[model samples]
Target: MSFHQEPAVYADLVSLNVKNLKNSIEFYTKVIGFKVVNETEQEANLSADGKTTILQLRKADHDRTNNRYTGLYHLALLLPSREDLALITMHLASNRVPLGSADHHVSEALYLEDIDGNGIEIYVDRDADKWIWNGSNVHMVTERLDAEDLLKDQPDPKDFTGLPADTIMGHVHLHVNNIEEAEKFYIDGLGFQVVSKFSDQALFMSTESYHHHVAANVWNGTSASSPKDGTVGLNYYRLVFPNKEILDQTVLRLNELSYETKDMGAYIEVIDPAGNHIHLVSQNAQN
Candidate 1:
């Protein structure tokens, strides 16, 4: 099976509740280089390629996002190659966009924020063979990336228009109230395995031996609550499963925990402890 395809559980589309639909739409298209697939007065669907809707932006009831709240830390956009990352990096630099760059041993990443202070991470993963693994843990580190070398690897400087067709919503990092509780929900309940960890601060989980597909941290505070209804931040995101059997099993697990869920035919919708919604979709339904 393809590592990124069959039998691999991965994060698909992420929906965000933005303060300004128009402004957020423009920022995603203009700065982030996504194609607007569909748009209504209050909502817009965007894609890296014209065919797949990777992001959904909806206008929120409130104007401000509480940074201290337990919600999205960042939504990661994974590029297909290093060259693609360099091209986008150059594009952002040309526009004088302030960015934070990092080399995580397993991937090189560029971090920035939207107009509403929502965090975004654009990154390209290193080859799977190059990743370091010890037992069940995949080693990941945060260090300054060599931006100059990455820029030098691009095909051409002026070809930056938008993200490539293969770009995807790779992973999402969330701020949770507690690490143990987050792991219990995602790893025990959702069936993801712990792939990496950071003391009491963070935990990373994945399936099929890949790097983390979901990460959670308690950096904000152990008692942080979910974002209020009017606040801006994560609305929901799709967790694409390999098949109906897995999806059904996950739903059963959620029910066992007494968590609420809404069955939507092809997918089941559930909320995390922090109130972030998750749409669990079956692979057959995805097709």
Candidate 2:
């Protein structure tokens, strides 16, 4: 009947558009510690540790149209194999990307951002049994992730290095206002299960049962937000449509829910209570 009316599980990632492709690539690979999956003059494919494609940076003009101060607050990239985390840990120390890392009881994460101010997080999932939940709130600690121990255990770079088959865009976060409304759109409206909720504070939801893959919270402490053209970041998010079937279904579902769909059916637009723009995109892999 509707696309997202059913649980629309996230299938794949296409790419992201940025003003500077080269700088973005360097930031992801060197600073954030991911491997370059592929690249072209316009866009570059990247991953956390060679497991799943994480991001594609595209060259776009800096203008009031897309510069909304979005600061794409670090899309999380889940390391495939456990060893994949070690390779990234070593690389982060070597390259130095602010080193703001944490070992949450639920997961271990490393955070970074691109040259264009898009955020990135490379992390590994802890077994589900280990997750500590407080009501709907998932208890994730803010403890420091021990980089030295993680690297020292692996020791030689030869043993744990380069691309692996386990890299994935684990989760994505957007700056928004009204955590409650956002939750309804993503969970009830979009059909993603609410794995955890900070309700009217922050959100963590997902398609499958593997914890949260998407989160949204208020920006700059604004109670309600309408991202201005001069804000200067967070262009658009690329959600891989499994095929035109799913894409068309998503369009119908969003439209029926009273959300705006645009670009002649190329994207879906739904505003959170704060008025931040969120787009569900459909594009060819080669696009």
Candidate 3:
């Protein structure tokens, strides 16, 4: 069966390099309520449900991730419902987990970081019909979330065991050195549409007109270089395209542009100009 067939193109999972495996795993499994799918000596895979892997934590020898490096800004986890989000909000509050809550017009999000300093966003999207759009650009705002209003409708008052089965990795935002270069790679090379843009600072791109699946910004300055290998930060993210033909065309386009890509049997891996690695996989390959 195809998982989350609506947003034809979306993120499958995010892999991160962390200094301490035990602490990071605990934070994700306990604080964030992600079930531990599998674990090994070097890495751990986590998800809301048992079948799908949403986040992966690989042990790293390097120190903490450098904020100056161009890498992950935040990995957004889309919950199944508003009650799930409210339950999480309650869990974070009772546990005293620091949160940065926001209402992005399109979604209600609560942000926090793991023990390894990788940013995490747990959120629930508003109705698709409710999302305002002006031509190609969708209107989004960063306003303080109304905590009282959000918590008022919580009918699920049970203990938080784990995230709902339908939870997914909503999107991944990266801190790149240049937004234009990012657009060239993501839009021109990978075949995503530019849904919204924030001047030259940030650009949100997606396929099938669902807000944004992937976003990038230059908040770290244009001179920011790629993170060193083995550093505690984003390793690579999986972008699952709708079908094989689209993936093939994307690979051909990138090759024609002289961008290097590695063929990993079922998928192709390409590194953007900003040194962020992306794995392009065919959605049909999931079965």
Candidate 4:
């Protein structure tokens, strides 16, 4: 079963504020290999498949801020295979785009920032059987990625056209002020299980045991503030549940925990303790 599909609550679309729509679009398309699904003067929707909108970039109303806010550490894009990752890595290198890479035991990831400095991660997971787990916690670590070995059998960089049609919005990592409160909101309120925890500093939560679908950390100081409105940063993210029953159950749980939710006809909206906006809806309900 696909962890991103039914029976698993996974992060889907993400919206971000960018200072310049044209520049952002160029960077995402030329450097990151995303296709423009649609666009307006102020906003553009990006897709890997040309049909499904996976990311939306909105021109910010104000100038970009350099503050370390409690939101959007990174949004990860999962590729179909390691070969795809290798090809993209070579593509970025050819374009002279600087990137950082790591092997996280469960996955190999390449990290870079958008023109507005929003973090982005492109990754491919290892086989599930190879993932190490100790009880409920998955053993994930940041280690040096063997780029030489990964690129040894890679196809030519000129063969790269764009991100694979099957690529997905894998997971989102956030910066939060309080770990306990964030845990209460994501775990207790939303019903995600703790797949891993890094002492009191970070937590990774997911459903169906497919590692983390959402992760939060207090790495930017415990008092990191939310970005100001119109700042170039995360606008919101969507979480897709398997079905309406589970979505309703999540609403009930959020209400029981005293968290406010706004009903938006097709989907419900909620804010995490650190001020990250979330839209919750069942897979079938999403447009």
Pairwise TM-score winner, candidates 1 and 4: 4
How are the candidates ranked when ordered by TM-score, highest leading? 4, 1, 3, 2
Please give each candidate's TM-score: 0.96, 0.75, 0.95, 0.98
lDDT of candidate 4 at residue 90, scale 0 to 100: 95
- Evaluated at residue 163, the lDDT of candidate 3 is 83
The RMSD of every model to the true structure, in order and in angstroms, is 1.6, 5.1, 2.1, 1.0
RMSD of 3: 2.1
Candidate 2, residue 248: Cα displacement in angstroms equals 5.6
Predicted structure 4, TM vs. truth: 0.98
Per-residue lDDT tens digits of candidate 3, residues 1-287? 22246347888789999988999889888888888888998999988887788888999868754478888999999888888889989888888899999999999999998887788988999988898999988899999999889899764435788788889899999999988888998888988899899889999998877888899999989999897767899988898887888789889999998899999886798999999888888876741
Off by over 4 Å in 2: 1-8, 32-42, 47-53, 63-68, 133-137, 146-149, 152-154, 157-161, 223-232, 240-250, 263-287
Candidate 1 lDDT for residue 21: 93
lDDT of each: 0.87, 0.61, 0.86, 0.92
Task: Return the candidate ranking by lDDT, descending.
Answer: 4, 1, 3, 2
- Model 3 lDDT at residue 84: 88
1 or 3: which has the higher TM-score? 1
Give the number of the best model, judged by TM-score.
4
Best by lDDT: 4
In candidate 4, how many Å is residue 28 off? 0.6
Off by over 4 Å in 3: 1-7, 154-158
